[model samples]
Target: MRTALTEMLGVEHPLVGFNRSPAVVAAVTNAGGFGVLAASMYSPTELDAQLTWIEEQVGGRPYGVDLLVPEKFAVSDPDDLVASLRAQIPAEHFAFVDALLDEYGLPAHSAPRGEEDALDEIAAAINPAGAQALLDVTFSHRIAMVANALGPPPADLVSRAHADGVVVASLVGQRKHAVRQLEAGVDVLVAQGTEAGGHTGTVATTVLTPEVVEVADGRPVLAAGGIATGAQMAAALALGAAGVWCGSVWLSSEEDITPRPVKEKFLAAGSSDTLRSRTMTGKPARQLRSAWHDAWDRPDAPAPLPLPLQPMLAGRAWNRVHAAAAEGHPGATALDTYFIGQVVGGFTELRPAAEITREMVEDCTRRLRALGELADT
Candidate 1:
């Protein structure tokens, strides 16, 4: 409990739960672990309300916020920005999406009629502006950290967080990426492996964590990917990680707000059920293999569009899938899925978040003690 990560986040435990729902964030923090709310999908006003509510719910417990600010994307100019990028998304992709929906027997819904309009919706939701708004709200509260979900936090954002006394962190999949993040003045490094959920890289944790730690040079490193159990957590620490950044394991937790169908997929998934694909978010992200992934991978299927574009293309269909999955529709069930790591194989049952965190800590503590005894020999 007194590990470097605990000190950094001011939490009793080093277990940090990253989730989109405020309830899970509050619960994890209240349970003595750091809870980080994903702010990528929220509007400025919505994020403000969410952070305010979380502050009240956690009752002074430390929490964090995650924002998506990819340094490389189409838009660079501030003038035609969102409009220009949206126009670049070919109409063929939308036509392909429409055809896919018809083939899947899903009903059509009115989507953004124009390219610029669609990109505007995505930019409003995920751009730096969105993160800045969230930061305004997060700093208003007592959040302990502000993590960029993708690449390095923008220098200005880092300056803002530092000025506000919040630690800046970024997720990295490779040693070089870790070095880049540290050079960018990031305070914490989350070394997430290919086995991690959501957007991830190809390296496995066993190989990636130590390399990241080496590069970070004592900067706090949170090992992520294929780390669902306490033994895995212990292995991470043994590999020089300061803590574990856990995501997939919490999807089945009682406190998790993941939709029922997606939750079910996670519960039933084997470690091999997941594959990395850019079909959902235009980045290589680990997600449960489903008919959806298969369709996207089809030889004839159009390549997935870039970040905001890809999500925009699939957002309507994904929304429909979630809705139908809620209704227990079989077709929707076949399409039901979300980002999860290979560790999802170990997630066979739903447990309380607090209970899961406790068990992991206890098991890791016990295992660590055994390893310590082995050193005596």
Candidate 2:
């Protein structure tokens, strides 16, 4: 359990749990692992509130925040960020989304009570000016690390984090990316392969881990993708990783905030049931196959838009889908899907986040010891 990651982050286990739920983040951190909250979908105010709540729950334990600072995104008027982004979305795409919902027999979507600013929240995470505002809020907190998946952290971000004595980490799918991130002065590199949820690449973890490790020049590299158990964690360490970065596995935890309907779909799904589809984020992200994707695959379906626009369009549709599914509507239930990984097939039951964290660390230690004994024999 004593690796560079554990030592750097001052945690007992070399595990990094990435999820959006503050409760899950606090639980993982308090259970002796570093928890990183996914902050890409929240407005600056919301993120600040969530981080504040996490601090209160963890009681000074170390945790991190992950952002979606893609190097390339649709440019919009900073003065009217939400409206500019929304206007860029073609009317035809809106029609397609509406027709798809009607085809699924879903009713008009209503934001459940206080989530009226959902689209604004999504728009803020991807817009440059808005991301800067979020960063300003992030630095005002007591975060131990900051992470991004799209590419190397902006030079100013690295400078800002370094000035604050915070660790900067980036997720890489190729050796070339590792080299760039190192040059950008990132302290940690996560070798996130295609098997991971959300935005990812086509490389396999078994292959990408060592490649990134080799180019990392002694920087700590965490192996991600298809890692949900202790044996897999051990395998990552054996591949020269300092630790593991897990996201999908947390979806099965009781503390995870993913909609219960989506969790049910994840529990019933097998490894093969997931696919990399661009219909969701306009990037090849892995998610459970659903009727929404099936509809997109049809000949008449419009091609998905780019980056922020795609999510802006899909976010509205998802609100409706989730609202209907929450009411036990069969059509909405069939279309309910969320980002997940191949390890989902291994999920059999929901457990507390602390239990999951402890089990993985203990099991990994035991497995490594057993392997060492076999070698001696």
Candidate 1: where is the Cα deviation over 4 Å?
76-83, 110-124
Model 2's TM-score against the true structure: 0.97
Q: Model 2: per-residue lDDT, tens digit, 1-377?
A: 79999989899999999999999999999999999999988888999999999999999888999998888665557677667877888999999999989989999766664464567556546855567878888898999999988898899999999999899999998999999999999999999989988888999999999999999888899999999999999999999999999999999999999999999999999999899988888888999999998999999989988877788789888988987898899999999999999999999999999999999999999999998999989
Candidate 1 lowest-lDDT run of ten: 115-124
Give the alpha-carbon lDDT of every model: 0.83, 0.90
Clashing pairs in 1: none
Residue 155's lDDT within candidate 2 is 92
Highest TM-score scorer: 2
Local error of candidate 1 at residue 78 (angstroms) = 4.7
In the order shown, the candidates' Cα RMSDs to the true structure are 2.3, 1.6
In the range 214-322, model 1's lDDT, one tens digit per residue, is 8888889999997878899899999999999998888979878778888988888888899999988888899999999888878878999877778877776787788
Q: Model 2 clash pairs?
A: none
Supply the TM-score for candidate 1: 0.94
